[model samples]
Target: MTEPESEGMVAQESLRHTYLQAIGVQSWLPRGALPHAAPSAPWVETFTWPPTQRFEQWEDAFEDTSEVPAAEQPVLPVTPSVNAPRGVSRALESLQGMFAPEGTPSQKVLESTPPALSETTPSASALDMSYQPEPVAPLQNPLAERYPEPQFSLVLMTLGELLIVDSLPPQGRQSFSPAHIRFVSALARSLGVQGYDINPIHHHWPAFVGSALNQGPDEALRSVRRLLGNMLKSQEIKRVLLLGEASAQWILEQPEPLDSLRGLRFSLRAGVAAVSSHSVTALLRIPELKAELWADLQPLLATRT
Candidate 1:
């Protein structure tokens, strides 16, 4: 061959290899190279099928034959050859692995994710409402019913006992006991002054004294005396009766015996006459004390006149 013709053939060969490489063929054979051996027949599909055959023909084709007895038929164990092409073996292995029992890593992760707790568990309200406690009612005091405000008076009498309705004064009487009631009524008539009952320990009195005198019930004389003093002087009251030992000693600031103090006239800071007397409750308990009371009252009543 001439030099130019040889060069043209070399260029064509180079172009062919380049084209093969671009098409993803890793290797190529020379144009006149011998052909590769044909691939082995598929073991599973070696027989040809007649597409137009009836069902009966297919049954006849698959039917067992005694001429070729089961004992005479040879069985071959099919396995891939170790000497098989690497690509062919790899492809076969991947195809076999497609039907494996275990799932893919991604599939396993999806299964491992826990179900929502709300879906599996019961709600708190659904479990029970009994656990939530009922609201409690507040407490109330019967202070008004227990103690009522007294009618206005200059000569206010503080009593120790709380007279319930069952122990109330009888008809035509001002106190629970008839004798003491008569005595008090007579004294009021003689003195020309009105009398009203009060209690130092009365439920309402503490609040009254607190607001009026800025003193607590514990400072008995100071609070009660201040309150009474203000009332007496403000209302131009001339006299007050301190009944019973508690009333007299507390309001008068006098710790003298009741016997010594009874019916005695002591002047208050407000210039009101404070007459110490035996309580009606005590007079009822000991009727004989009335004589002593009458004796004591004569001097005090005489001064009033």
Candidate 2:
């Protein structure tokens, strides 16, 4: 995309996330399977338990009664100096030290400060004490560890190649049409990782191919080079699964004299393996991949007829 278009998307994303944060909603709402809007009249549903069945104790009643004022929260006078294990006493002493004001205490002042003690069993008052809810543990990064950051990080990997058989002259290809994605899904399924194929097809190959189409050869080549460099440098990826022979050739950029990717001068990075596979038709004929993944990935790559 153009700089302006990219910037606009970033700005929109920022606004959406910021709004969600302000409203104290879960970030997953945007990423999750749940609907984004309120339920319709027919879909809306609600029910409540009887109060006795709902609450088991007085504290529960107190919590349920929002009518109680925060200022009216009575501070219970807890008895002190009950005998406790040395560990418990020491822990309480440490806690008191942390919460209490600074400086050595005079004997008189120490005497006034309640002894460090907790009942062998917690007192009703201690059990009833409530704390204000802390802010949600800083929202965990949604994408961390799930996807490679868009930076260039190289890794040793098993790489596969895919080549798309182009359509007839009447129908020229542009971006990743159905064939490319189907091949990717097919490859992934050839392994046993059982998630929808929609993911990598959107993020991985497109990162390279999309660059080429929008900005022309040099720019596209640069993106692919960087992606490869990063993949090796960062160790972010492991296996390299090439989808179709045509896609494999496109990346290899054989301008002419290449009928099939089988003859392409592709090099596997040291320590990384590359598995070049036949298309869906070739594999669909067989019930199983040489292994399960070939079978699995092939189906994921296949487009619904």
Candidate 3:
């Protein structure tokens, strides 16, 4: 470059540096360094700046002093004397005499005298006061231990009835169809039972027998009978009406025709009796079977009064 241009550039850089220093910004490089070749700025360490006059006064007030102030000195605890005062000394001596193993009066008397004989027999009242075995806690309810107790007695329906009932819309109605309920209610009334109240305890034939559904009818029926036994223990079921031939045949443990079994008395669980009859659903399909059902209920009616 030409001499004039180089001198002009040098003068401009000097002017910029002077301006920055005037505004309290320190020079970032050596004083005479050209602006184009300026070195990097070095980092400075930071420090916590201390407070001024007020804090200085606080420090003076908090400074420790060695001189003892003019006030009462703390009292040193007095050690007790080896010789106690008259009254306390006398009381101590009496306590020592009473508790001494060899010197005690009770000990001396016991050593000098023979042991007295114990009574030959304890009194009856003393015997009564002796420990007696605690009563055994009542056995846990057998039904609760086995399964959740179904609340209702005598569920009256065929095994396949659940299939039809479950298919229907489950809202604005009882679990069973209206017609079936009406027929059962009528049958219950005819038998002289008050309020045909029963919960639809199972849905689908499989639920009635649980996992036994895969094992054939006899196994399923056995499971159902076991379930009924639990119900008898848990609920106050007087009579379970085994509607439908499948239920009756299994529960009664007899394959006899409905004609022979309908009117006959059949024992079920220990305290419960089961009466066999045609289901109301079957009667709805074949109105003729209802006559036989009515006849079957006669024995149940006789005991109602």
Give lDDT tens digits, candidate 3, residues 24-98. 575543444356985532211111112123133322222323264423322222222343223323433333333
lDDT tens readout by residue for model 2, 1-75: 565555444434434443444355645323223558654322111111221331233213213333766455443
lDDT of 1 by residue, 94-167 (tens): 43343223333334334555777777688776786666677866423222232233211112433221110011
Best by lDDT: 3
State residue 23's C-alpha deviation in candidate 3, in Å: 78
TM-score for candidate 2, please give it: 0.27
Q: In angstroms, how far off is 147's CA in candidate 3? A: 27
Q: What is the lDDT of residue 170 in candidate 2?
A: 16
lDDT of each: 0.45, 0.37, 0.47
TM-score for each model = 0.34, 0.27, 0.39
Colliding pairs, model 1: none
Deviation from native of the Cα of residue 252 in model 2, angstroms: 3.5
